[model samples]
Target: MQRELIDGVPVLWAETPGPLEATLVFGCGVRDETFRTLGVTHLVEHLAMSTLPRLHFDHNASVDLALTQFTCTGRPEQVADFLERVCSALCALPLERIEREAGVLEAEGSGVADPTTAELLSIRYGTAGVGLASFGGPGPDRIPVEAVQDTVARFFHAQNAALVLTGAPPAGLRLPLPAGERPARATGQPVRQAGPAWQQAQVPGPGLALSCDLNDQAVFLAVQLLRQRLTEAVRHREGLTYDVGGDVVFVAPGRGERTICMEAREGQEQRVTELLWQEALRLATEEAPEAELAEEVEAAREVLLDPRAVEYELMEAAAELVLGDAPMRGRARLDLIEKLTPARLREAFAAALGSALLVVPCDIEVRPRRADGTELPQFSCGQGGELPTVGESSARP
Candidate 1:
């Protein structure tokens, strides 16, 4: 990979097999907004794209949990034109278009994460920062014009942005975004449930979330191994689950949530939930075999070392730059993965499970347990299952 600067914005580029692809990434997304200004970042994204003329080439934009990306894949000139127009639109977004774009966004429907992961986040962080994923705060129509302007001024700027490309930077490519200092980000987010607890939520199936270091290779492998074990037990052996997967949500530097979500067949929600807990406890208590660890490590290497992953890797690097993280290259990461022993992976996973939050479907009742046979606490949003009347209630717009 090569690094350079364009109009004071950091640019990372590398050679890959594809039409020229470029992404302008900013270090802001749903996590940067509050309940009152929910969806403001996405509203900003829509307003910017609404200004572009319809073109035949592929171009689009998206806002995720912690980053917003404007991406295009076309000839060099086309890519350059797309980036320029996006930056220009962001700088001078037509306030007049806010109402129309709000309606458009309403039709589009906003969802930052899947239901299970969102519920886990809400359980972990309450109703602020990354926790807002589970909330649908006042609709897009409620996002104020002033909020949009302020969001753009604070986050959509050159210093908070990074550009990455599959090919060399296009000739004459310019990022003419407004200049501003990168805003301070939290190194450790406040926690609501530092828990080994279970709760009922509106999720498709049971999910487990463990707070851990995002960069920990052992925890990474543990998650992969857990997913594999669940798939083997819940899907193939029991035939109760249709899909089993996991996701990692970034909270701050070296801090994040590792979530395992499973979608079970109808009428098997409780069974799947029980099985999930059993497997999680087993993985936490028992050491994995060397063969299983090697299998997972090889699978990871195949995906990371594949040539087609170049663009994905570059986009990740750009996100790291925008989020104030030190980027790890594929080769370097593979080297770390190769050295992980089964004992180390098991130890890391066991430590992480100490802070596990389990969420099951609302209709299911469960009493999950830790490896030592102690029952996990049942989660409640308020004291004695009732809302607190002591705090002031603020009305929404």
Candidate 2:
């Protein structure tokens, strides 16, 4: 990837055989908001895109867990115009449109993570940072203008943003966002339940979350192996599930939450939940077969060599810069995956299971156990303690 500075913002680009693609990425996202201010980043994205005039081009904006992006695909001039307008809008957001746009946001009530994944994050980090995903908080219509202003001031600026393109930077392209210092990186998240526990929520199926080093090749392969097992056991064999997938959520530099979510056939939630736990314990204990491990490695190889990897890698580089993670470009994940042994995979997975949180539907009843015969504890939102007498609390005198 080629790197340069455009109007004080770092620009990363590469050549690809397609329409020119340009993306403006900022460091702020849902993780930067409080419960009362949830969805504010998304609202800001909508507000910026609203300023653009109707044009026949592929352009849009989005906000995720750790970054906000405005992208466009077209001729170089069209792409340049779209980005210029977006940056101008950020410098002077039309606050009058907040109420109208809030209604639009309310009509489009969506979240970045699935319900199960969101609930697991809340269990892991309380109702802040990544945990805020589980909540809708105040209605968008109630989001104060002050919150939007503060978000832009803190995050939407030249110093806190990066741009990437599918080709070289267009001639005369500019990023006119206001000048501001980048905010401090978030680290050492507060934990609510750092454990091997289970909880019930309004989720479609069973899910599991494990905390581990984001760069751990063994854990990455273990997740892939577990997903494959769930697909075989719950979907192919029992016909109790339809979808098996997961996401690796970036929490801090070198740390993350790996989540696996399965969609079960109705009335078979219990069986699916049991199989999910069973497979997890089985992987944690037994060594994976050589054939199974080889299959995963081959899959990893395919992804690294695909044609679209260049664009993906550029986007990843911008995200790393925004999120304060060290550039992982030097480390070859595929090479590391090839060197992993079944015993190493089992050990890494077993270590991660020590910090696992499981989520099942509210109607499902379960008492899951670890491989060592100890049962995983159930999670509770409230502390278990007696309350003081109403208006007459006991005090030490």
Candidate 3:
């Protein structure tokens, strides 16, 4: 276990050989609540990836609102070479950090027709409840091009980076040390906007609408289990949807949400969303039936509490604490789950089910066409439209 400071920020690290699996894994460090940095860091990762000539494995980087991480998975023989290259890559990544005043990624939707596919895409997304509205992820609408440039620049700067290498520590590894130290950065959490912006946008009637968010140590486990069940039910059992699932955003400081979405086959979009919604409602409202609960709990245990004590599972726990601040770690979480009663999980589910809905959007990305066979330009729209805002009229709908 060698945790050090490169460019000044403290990075948590370790290396070990999966004597059983022969896998070599690595990770990166965090600068809290830098969501744009996450995308930027990933962009830099893609840009600098050209440097690793010796690497012959899967390489990727992930940045969230809480931390930025770069990782590589390789065979035992190439582990040492990969680490050295990574060390150099982090220091040399070309970033022209752009600091700008944050803008509401929304715009006054000009009644212009989108000309190109890119422009059409911009418009398609603009109407979705996505915009620079604080709950991150490229909204389903036109994003200011400058926001993309600004994030890319911030990712290249020196002061905000940390790298971790796992698997075996190379015996004769040579690491470059810089003379000018990196200064410490304060880690601030990203705040969600005043109200919930992450809601379902309405399209044609009877389409699916679903939302789910969970903050727990067993989140990944929950995701895996949830996906499995949903896939089996939606795709396999009833075959109601061709596509169905959500994102498990693993952010820091005990914060991460699970989102589930599904559009029906042909006219089933509404049907699928309703079914998907039931599952979210089900997870919260129903007690875990013996067989299902046992199966899910077991699945959760495997994913969240992998047998490998200090590998991916350990890293996630550390990420939860360092980034999110809650969830069990190391051996502690495993033990906790073993003692978890089915009743406990059921109650937890019920509480979440009854909670108030955060966002519920109408006018999802419908392909509203014009008389001249022209499509609308993708301008990021604000909260209101030519019609009144959401609450102003029960009369309008």
Candidate 4:
């Protein structure tokens, strides 16, 4: 991987020796906006890429909590052309299509009910910053053209962006963006409460959800080990769930969120919750096996060495840069993973117990209580609606 500066924007290039694929990653995303203008960045993304459908290259745009990206795969020249056109389109966004795009956003929003992470975030961090994911962004109709333009000028600039190419540098690619400073990371507005709390939600099936603070490398390894243990107990042994896994999500600098989730069979919600806690307790007390840790490390190495990994890593680095974080290279990450000792992982698991949050079936009368025997908090619906019962379809918290 090589890093260069073109027109004052950082560009990361890797010669993967395959068909050309490139992505223009910007520092702006849902995290950059306020509750009043929540979906504005996404709206801008849609309008900016509206012209791509008419082009020959395969291309798309995505807006996540912390970044927006435009990606394309094609011949080098074709990819260059696509990116150039996108940069130009961003420079002068089509404000006339604001209403049209707003309709599109509304339609899109309707299809997606609240997601589990969004609900968790809302519970963890109120209805602003990261919590806006649960609240839904400001209505498109309320966002003005000037607001969109200002956001574009502030975030979609040379200093706040990076261009990553997988095959080779696209010839004659120009990022004609105006000068601007990198945008600051979003500061989440956390709810005024301590956790190790429990919450419940109504959904079609039973499931177990867990969240913990991402404090260090040990916490990350602990999350992975927890997922393995949960899968074994819930899916393989008890046959209570069909899906069981966990993921560590990047929230901000020196902070992350880990989630362990499982989908359960009908009438198995309470059992699944109990089993999950049992595993959690075991993990907290017992050390992870050396064999298991080695196996997981090898699996991670395989993923990092995969052909597609660099592209993903490059985009991740771009997002980290925007958040004022120095990205860890692949070698550094592997070294950390290699040094993960059973004792260190156990300590991390112990610390995770302090701030754990669990979500279970709302209708289940006997929910899993915290280890400390305290009452768990219930997450209310933002729309002033009643929580879903077991038989009804549940919306995200």
Instruction: Tell me each candidate's TM-score.
Output: 0.95, 0.95, 0.56, 0.87
lDDT of each: 0.88, 0.89, 0.41, 0.73
- The TM-score between candidate 1 and the true structure equals 0.95
| Worst ten in a row by lDDT for model 2 | 322-331
Q: What tens-digit string does per-residue lDDT give for candidate 1 at 1-397? A: 8899999899998898879888899999889898999999999999899999997799989998899999889999999999999999999998899899889988988689878999899887878888999998999999999999999999999999999988899899888998998888655465656888888989999999999887787888889989999999999999998789778788887688889999989989999999999988888888888999999999989988999878777777888888876656788888999999988988999999988999999998788877778888888866556776898788896
Alpha-carbon runs more than 4 Å astray in model 3? 1-39, 51-69, 73-78, 89-166, 177-198, 202-229, 242-244, 304-310, 317-327, 354-397
lDDT string, candidate 4, 1-397, tens digits:
7888877778888777678888888887776788788788988898888856587768888888777889989997888788888888989888899999999988887311236555566667776666666666558878988889989988998888888888657768788877897676655646735466667765433323334444365677777777787888888888988877554555667666676767678888788888877778677778888998888788878877787787777766776666665556666777887898998888877777767766666777654555466555544554557865768675999
Residue 258, candidate 2: C-alpha displacement in angstroms: 0.5
Scored by lDDT, the top model is 2
Q: 1 or 4: which has the higher TM-score?
A: 1
lDDT of 1: 0.88
The candidate maximizing TM-score is 2
Local error of candidate 1 at residue 41 (angstroms): 0.7
Which segments of candidate 2 are over 4 A away from where they belong?
384-397
Worst 10-residue stretch by lDDT in candidate 3?
A: 109-118
Stretches of model 4 off by over 4 angstroms after superposition: 110-114, 202-215, 367-397
Candidate 4 collision pairs: none
Clashes in model 2: which pairs? none
Q: How well is each residue in 1-397 modelled by candidate 2, as lDDT tens digits?
A: 8999988899999899999999899999889998899989999999988888998999989988888999989999999999999999999888989999999999998888888888888878888888887889978988899999999999999889999999988899988988899798657485766788898889999999999998888999999999999998888898897889788898888898999998888889999999999999999999999999999989888888787888888988998878887535523888798999999999999999989999999997888987888888887767668866678766799
